[model samples]
Target: MHSGMTDVTFQLRYGSNLTYECSLAADRVVASHLPPPALTDLPARLSEALAAPLEFPALHQAIVPGDNVTIVLERDTPQAGALLAAVWKEIASRGVAPDHLTVLQPASYRSQPPTDPRDALPADVREHVTWKVHEPATEVECAYLASTAAGERIYLAREAVEADFVLTVGELAFDTLLGYRGTSSSLYPGLSTAEALRRSHGQGHDELSPDDQRPLRELTDEIHWLLGGQFSLQVIAADGQNVSAVVAGQADAVLRHGKKLLAETWRFEVPARPELVLVAVEADAGGHHWSQVAAALDAARHIVARDGRIVLLSELEEEATDGILMIRDARTPRDALQPLRQAAPADLIAATQLARTIDWANVYLLSRQDHDLVEDLFMIPLEDENEVDRILDGDEPCAVIGGGQHTLTHLQNR
Candidate 1:
């Protein structure tokens, strides 16, 4: 109990009367509050935003009267079914028969099987469209080796490069590797051959820097450029619940709108100084996993007074970018950079960029994983609820933000 207040719970109220509650005793509550909403009311908001008729050039249209158009959906997207429904509605309104469209999803990496594709797509559309499950290529034997005056081995994804028209539907959030995930992400890592992914992942980890052209961004840009040159694209951005506010055409235009919306929704305000900060990662939402780490670090860097402590809470259901799982175990900011630097080539690209750009060392963490590892890497002890109470009692006031498994609560000497 904190300060003799034995029963402590965090209450969140949404849309005036809708409320959700969680016990504060848990390491991560999976629910909390932030100053600004991410895409909280996605369904309602996106329906309203997309209600108007979309305007596309005649040349830009890919679905001809009888053309079989394939829709490539991203796995991490929140509400694939809802988004597909909206797209289908739009397509139908454009006079394209439901039978002319096809639906496809990427294969899963985790033990948990992917959602049934039939459940996500409408029955009518499902009947008409052929469902293709594209797994990442196991053996990428074909590598485009180029030898010029200055020889450099450049490998590209044949399948991704050959797609007729690829439409990417997903949320826009801060990613550890790519500043954001959407658009061309489906091309390189999503549809690209395994070898290309390995090459990109390896190279990204090795040569990644603090610059704008870091591996993830560079690769994303390359895929985007190629896709734009080859085929047409339809990009959508939604609020927290997968409600889309903006539907953009072309690779550049879509990414631009997405970045703007992400900046508005994801950016948080920071007090000049704070003593302690807390961040939580929701267990069910995989998309928010790494983004939560990035967000936790961002918030920690902003509010914590020099030498102040911060805590991160997460279940870590998803793997770390580039497989650098020991980031939580870093003893100091400097100490963390080395292992991140030594990461495999692809992993290094994303990890080094995140290390250089994000300030993570100031924070502590409370999680289900190895607490000692976290302490060794970040040099901050992971605390139980009782320990948190003691720390809160000694220091200043605390403020909490976040929702789902990734929650943030902080105690600061104000």
Candidate 2:
């Protein structure tokens, strides 16, 4: 804590680069931790991993002539631009025209695609390729696939299923539903119909370990088994942009290798469980989506004391605020969870999980979202940024979380 004339000055990041200055007592400022430093030479690292993928043939050997290749990417994966450029250069050398390639990003269920395809691809290569937003929520856009053992109808995006070649690029992070975001999982929950997406995601709703694997992995296995020759490129990314480590090839193999790299980079050892957890949700586009807020709470769980306080700062700019409304409407956290268990509402899985966290801790949030709406969810709302300390009310030894969605805090002695 830095010294101030009247009070201690704590300058903390409220958004990506925006700062929040709070004045509190020096003793109350218990601890501060920064995120892991970024990896150097990101492009070369991505190129190297793509050049020699584990458990799969090299890029050229994998893609043959006349193949209609589809590259799956999430909205947040700008690094896909680099991965695509590298792969495209290789494919082009072997006479694979750019017209034969399609870049697919999972569309938000029941809505139009969230991002412009041009924004996700490299400028040099963007013009030469085709881009499609995979819409599993749309009836015509999906096809009838085999149902799960649980009897959930499996409808997959037709483009991804019908494509002659599939290569997915995504970063590894702690996912609230599936343990981690691997390549296979991207196909579904984004490319599946609304019912299938909700059913699969709602399966895991408790404290999810990074190592726990079940339905998601099993589902991935079945999908690959049914539709052979699927390839994945997984990354351990810092700040969601810089690629440090990468693993590619078979989705299961990529999942295994990516998890190891992910644990090393994203996990941190905190000295003690803090009385207060302050998490800043960076203000990227769609940064404050319900899933992201829930993920931040998940990261906080690793270091927050039982019944402690958690403060979040985010823009909450996503079009939907259903989760917040769900929390507000329920009489208690348990009441809110019942519907999520029965019917998963797209990516709003966070509302159910966030309610559970609220049951354990008092969460305070700062967002552009409606204050009444924020308060209706049983969380304390911070009106002004500077009032962070005032709301903290001298709760000392607070833990401030940056990159809340992408970070995991582990206890040093636990």
How does each model score on lDDT? 0.48, 0.69
Clash pairs, candidate 2, are: 30-397
Tens-digit per-residue lDDT, 1-414, candidate 2: 367665566555545567766666566655555445556876676667767878877777887888888877766663666666776766776677778888787756533345554544557667879877765556999877666667756777777778888887777677656677667766766777766655565635355565676577667657755656467876665543456676777777887777777777677677778888877766433344677777787677667888898988776645545665666778987687776566556545667668777888888888776777767778788777766657677746777666677776678765
All candidates: TM-score: 0.65, 0.82
Return the top candidate by lDDT. 2
Tell me the alpha-carbon RMSD of every candidate: 7.6, 4.1
lDDT tens per residue, model 1, 128-180 = 66555555665462334233233434433343334344456554544445655
Error of 2 at 339 (Å): 4.2
Against the true structure, candidate 1 has what lDDT?
0.48
Candidate 1 regions with alpha-carbon error over 4 angstroms = 1-35, 38-62, 93-100, 104-114, 127-133, 136-164, 202-222, 228-246, 269-273, 287-303, 315-336, 345-364, 370-387, 394-400, 403-414
